[model samples]
Target: TVIDGVTNTTTTVTAGTNPNAIAVNPVTNKVYVANLNSNDVTVIDGTTNATTTVTAGTLPYAIAVNPVTNKVYVANFGSNNVTVIDGATNTTTTVAAGTSPVAIAVNPVTNKVYVANQISNNVTVIDGVTNTPTIVTVGTSPYAIAVNPVTNKVYVANQLSYNVTVIDVASNTTTTVTTGKRHNAIAVHPVTNKVYVTNQNSTNVTVIDGVTNTPTIVTTGKSPYAIAVNPVTNKVYVANYFSDNVTTVIDGVTNTTTTVTAGTNPNAIAVNPVTNKVYVANSGSDNVTVISPSIDTALPLTTAVTSSSLVNVAGISNATVSSAPAFTFTATSTYAPTAPAIRTVYYQVDSASGPWIQASGAGPFTATLPAQSKGDHVLYAFAVDGLEGGATAGSSGEGSGNSPMVGSVAAFAFSVIDPLAQIITFGANPGPVNYSPSGTFTVSATGGASGNAVSFTSTTTGVCTISGTTVTMVTAGTCTIAANQAGNTDFTAAAQVTQSITINPILPCTPGNFSATGNAPCTPAPAGSFVPTAGATAAIACAIGSYQPNSGSISCTLASVGFFVPLTASTSQTPCPLGSTTLITGASACLNLPLLNIDNSDPATVYDANTDAVLLTRYLLGYRNADLIANARGTGANLRDAAQIETHLSTYIPTNQALSPFDVDGDGVVLPMTDGLMILRRLLNPNALNVMTAAEQSAITANAKRGSLTDAQVLQRIEALKP
Candidate 1:
């Protein structure tokens, strides 16, 4: 239930079953009500009166909101956990707590949540950033919780243990405080650094000294269930459940009490410190009682600018706003309200019966009037109590309200001058501009109110000049560019924006662009792009068949053989896939693998098997000279020793290739101990190679499989390579 303070009106919104606890985020104007039976929370939008239901843990008994993080925490008694609700997204994250988490409070300044666990006799301290929980042991059956954000302390009221536990959030250490019996509620006066605990089972309230942590009893009406304090007035209101319609109001400074009449069973209480109004929720009477100090019927005072009224025709003594006529005015003679409520000043143009609109918040307020048409304009300025559309306070943001006017309306009969409406801004900050290459760059101007084309003019006499939208540098000095747009019949001429573009006299090579080999200009393009322009350069992507991996390249490098360039501006090469080949230098794609002639023996291309295998054995055993040609079948067997054999093997396996026929085991590497041995065995005795014994395979040493395939994989590849 929400109430209007000014009209004494009540608005009730629906929530889930057994709504037991309520919390509000004043910054977002969102109200959160925890429903114990429904195991959910109902979020009410203060502006629209709409409701959104969010699921919480079982039996959400207590709730608190941290306005800074826009998060709400609900202490679930049945689930032994707390459900945190994101106010912006309405999402929930359940954080584990101690047993029977009954009550919760938040220190918004520290972004920490404190939940009092009744069964576990501890308090769960939840860090808002990580939503992580840390348990701090407290008195037995800790029930109610309160936080002192200013001092970073948490106070818990223990029902069964009959004491208050103050936890210093910085240290996570506890200070036991002796207080009244069966503490049901606790409140902290941050400015005073004092703590107050209400004993529901007794006729007194416990006051704990802030510095000493010592408890003092302040007598109150019987059975106080809930309590509230007004930091502004230093007055505390205690809701005595069984006090028979009497609420004890204690002066915080004097520690004295005054009994005020209220509805039966004043169980919940709140205070509007700014208004000095106390509101009590009397559960037994089914009504809320509003308590306020006496207010005298003194009309609010107001005044407007002193001026010789302009005639609307051609006659004018001065501008409505004077002395070069700027738009600004303090809402003078508008303050020092006799009533205690916060006040706002409102204004209406040309109409007295129309809705009053607030121009500023709390004074000293200033109002910026909008551009008005030509006419004798009378601006009605007055003040009202509270926020601008707020029944108690006027609405805040140029808000609309029809509340009764507080003071004398000030009327200024002034001609409405279509203000210099055009506001022009440079597309970029013209702080410093370079002068090289074409000695020119395009300038842009926007935000012309009359939709007129903006023109540029060079303000500097000789250093620089402008033609159309382009600014050409004449020399190295300050180049001031002024942009302007002529107003139409409706608007006045726009104020031009003059920007001085500095071109240094002694130009040192700027960062990013370095000097060439002998102190000349060097504008290097970024990697994968080249051919940079003089000013604000954006080089195009490297052409196909070429790449520029480093900055400031004169040209892109052509792709070499064994690699292909498929994409534009490719900084790296791509290898052909398995069983594919490309012989063309600077090729963009790979072709199907050619039918390889492995012989290279006496018959050149013909593999009769025996002679070709023997020649390869000679090449493998590091044989050189005539030994490489001994019994070789082909005169084309130029391969001998390591480098020549490596070159021959590379022809079949392109750069970065993963697989090749020469790598018989296809383990992506050719090792003498494994691949070479297997190849020789296959050529010498193809029939017995598949059944090689484990002892023989042990010769495939560690380096053979270091970053390649395993021995089992090598064996599988050997099987696949078999005839």
Candidate 2:
């Protein structure tokens, strides 16, 4: 539905499916509508009712027309591409764009187009002459875009990062300007070089100074979305979607605003600088509301300042009040309205940017504002009359849409004095602290402004913990303490002050203890055991080759060579006895010397053939067998043996009188012809030459054990029998 401004009548012009955004070319008198679902554009001829359907990229979201260049641009969100159409021929060129292109704006003077890519977090700058694209990086989630043709600068609003990216056309370099959280829409006034951005999440507007790139916050109604600018009047129009049928008009000169009644859910807004009129598209009511400011706002002239001078809400004629004052208004309009000039009085604290409260009644109407903040404040207000077709009402409280009247902006200033000054004081800094013991702190406060009693807290949670005024160090680092005192009725609240505290770290464990993670408290090794490494748990014992005489030692000593430690954890090593010895270290037992058990007839040191052999021969003949081994001539023959000769009777080899202790050789028989004869021959000859055959000189018997025995073997058995 299109409304004729002159006739005040409506006409229906058919468009493509789900038509969302519209743009117009004043030079050609052409209108373009972007159809999101149909993936095309519906072009309407302004002179005639003719319509043309032109194909575009998928899900076309935003459209902008360059009247000077006679070109139109559409940003396709789904296709990640841009559709550019020639206004003269309706021919379109598909240009590749960044991912998820959401908004597009053009600079007609420079003939350049900029598309904001939300997902890619960058912008694609397109040259109108060639349709070529250049990607310029931006902040995260770029949602809206606008351009200043005069300065040749492009601005992109990043919703997630809460900042605006300003791109210089000459250098392509960007400067970031911070804004409120989750900003969705932006508008730039070319003449003032000021940018207006609507932040939906924060319910405010961020006004950016183009020269300094500085941002100043302007309060707005809930969820402000669409924005437009009228450079001629220096006014910025903002559509407050959740604010319930209202739009805030901001003065670029003073940053002050006046709320005029609009339509339900007044979302999309635009202005005509040529006519100085503003138009708003109401989504909920499905109609367009035209607002004519009628020369500096249709303000009713008041005769005199009535009780509680209520003109400016700043309406108080620049008067300052100490308390909340009651207001009464009486005024007349120039156009001669159907009702009183001042039918209702609407005002808001601080600025005219509302949530405005209204007082609608007959002449001498009176109203009072609720409790206000204590500081310099301006009360902005406007009056609406019963004149037909003046302004629309954004809310039911705005009365009839017949006459839209806000009073002449008079400066209203007021001050509320505070009774007491409350502050929190913390003692001097307590330098660095050890991690071992916790520290205690004291605080003093004047409670009314600071709030409640004095309380302590730690800002660095990972480094320290605080309970009341006590601080416990958790690790090595810096610890900051914040002291707060919530105020009472006499004061508002005191600002929080802080102090710095340092925490020293703990040391590592020493040797002779098992301390894991390098903490304190080391353990000692067990008795007769030792540990080699610091912070070790395992204990090493003394082995056969090594010993540790003390406990809690780092190492053990090796046993000396020829000495031995037989058991584990032994304090000392033992040495071998007289007859038995060990040649190596760590021996468990010593070996005895080999026993020489020869000398059957004599226990004496020396032996000869004369006396010892004669006794042995006679004894072997079986005469007095007991005296055979009991020979007096040879010192009781073999009374003791070699192994324990002197004292050990158990180890003595006793004389065997049955035959002979030795048969001169290892043969079984002890006959005179064999053993006895061999002993006699050896003892009698001594070094004499043998006078016998080889068979007779052989071991004296045919037995293999006797006959194979050499003379040295037979003599060695009888202790080398010789005279």
Candidate 3:
């Protein structure tokens, strides 16, 4: 069953006997009751009110919970053992403890429970994570344990010793301080993180600073048995068992106390920090009493200068705040001011509360707080605007629905902001030379800031070339092109390009024939040396008349026939060009010239078609016989003597025609016969024009004897003369 303190009622759970302590599981809203008379624990379903009683140690007077572990520890006063109940299973385990454990409290920060053994005058610290107990020393008759969440400290009320012990949860050390007399029950103010211990004999409550463990005794009505705190209003409530009433009030701030009437003998109390409500166990009345903060009020503005206090006065730049502090007044609220006044802001050393100081004011409507200690600090501001009668604080930009206090000041809270720089990244990297001849290359800058110019230079030479946004690469090689801005002489970005060049070599002539004057006369022959008879116009004349050469050894020279036909320039033929030759008859007077006397030379009937008769007879036989051949070594000739030609002629003519009588005619001289072997030899020698063989001569002679040489003979001669 869940207890509602504001409504003064418990939900789901009905009337039960001697509910010593009522602990609610906020998760399930189920109420667990420690029944002092029944020696058992009753689990009441919050929604249904169904009661299930589980047997436990005798007289369970105190109960504490570990919300994270889902376990509960009940201090069984009569049994001398704490009943540990697993919330999940409702199963119990009895853990041994010292004599008469009166109160139990859990440190939610560590989930550890600290139990006060009243008779033993000591405390047992149970580890929630490990389920182990540590016996710790304390004052006489340690009766109650109350923990401070912010400092993780446990405060134990020593009833007999009239003092309280503060146990540092982290170090497990204790510091004891005497309050008044019979310090029994204790509670912690969730909002202020302060501990309130009720001194039963002294009829006063002691307030201990959770952070400092310093105590301040607050006088109450009668002997206080139970204590609770309202987290919302940060007030302490203590139940005076003998008076049958609870005194409710703020511990440090307020001077007076308000009493809350409850059931008889209110011995146990639990406060819900979230809702700021209290649940009291009235053992004599057999019921639980619920209470809320009925008279909670807003704090008065502080006038003393403290770091945490806000300044409300307008145009008060060098301001201090304390007891008469600045209050945050709302425009819509009845406490708001009707006129505007400037509000000053300040900070403190390492905390919001401090000795207030002035700050600089810059620009219009802007106040700059001076730097303070390293720790966190908060700034608060409020303006005092005078209305019709008196002055009230003005609301600036405060949150809605909350109380109007010093926090509602405008420009009171601010933080500082910090600036940084951006880093640049490059896409491509630079490397070795890219050109063939190794010249510095000018490169373009792309993919970077627009209009950013780049410079290319030879790293070794310091020769610089500037580039525009779109640069053309001129001289190619390894050139460091640095991308730079105007006035940034030291380039930040750079790259490189490598190029290879290829050129073809010049070509020469193919090492073959090319001449200035025709082609070397086709062959190395004598000048004007005719291929056939020099003056012959008929194919028949060339076929049988003489041996002439266009190439090789038998090439004829017209100069050798000087005696036969003397050089003449009497008349121009006009048959061709002026300097060219035309057919003209030489006088018969020179016909009988010794050089032209073919009739008397040899037997005019015979001729060696392959032989140079005049050259052979004059050079070898010592005569210029018309029937003889000339033998002379040419300047570029490969032949040596006439014997070689004679041998060559024998192979062409089939039989050698010597200057013997057998070959001579009746004139006692042999002529190269126009109708003999001369015609046949000419056909065999590819270099000869006129020389012929016996069979060729016989054929030609046979044709001549027929009086009309057959057309077949003529065609044969023409075909043989072709290349």
Which candidate comes out best when scored by TM-score? 1
Over 4 Å off, model 2: 296-723
RMSD of each: 24.0, 25.3, 27.6
All candidates' TM-scores? Answer: 0.45, 0.42, 0.41
Give the TM-score comparing model 2 with the true structure, all chains together.
Answer: 0.42
Q: What is the lDDT for 567 in model 1?
A: 88
Ranking of predictions according to TM-score = 1, 2, 3
Error of 3 at 405 (Å): 8.7
lDDT tens readout by residue for model 2, 320-385? 233465555555555544445456656665543437677545765556767643333444555666
In angstroms, the error of model 2 at 17 is: 0.7
Candidate 1 wrongly placed segments (more than 4 Å)? 295-723
lDDT, ranked from best to worst:
1, 2, 3
Better of 1 and 3 by lDDT: 1
lDDT of each: 0.69, 0.68, 0.51
What lDDT score goes with residue 369 in model 3? Answer: 43
What stretches of model 3 exceed 4 Å from their correct place? 1-17, 260-723
Tell me the lDDT of model 1 at 593.
31
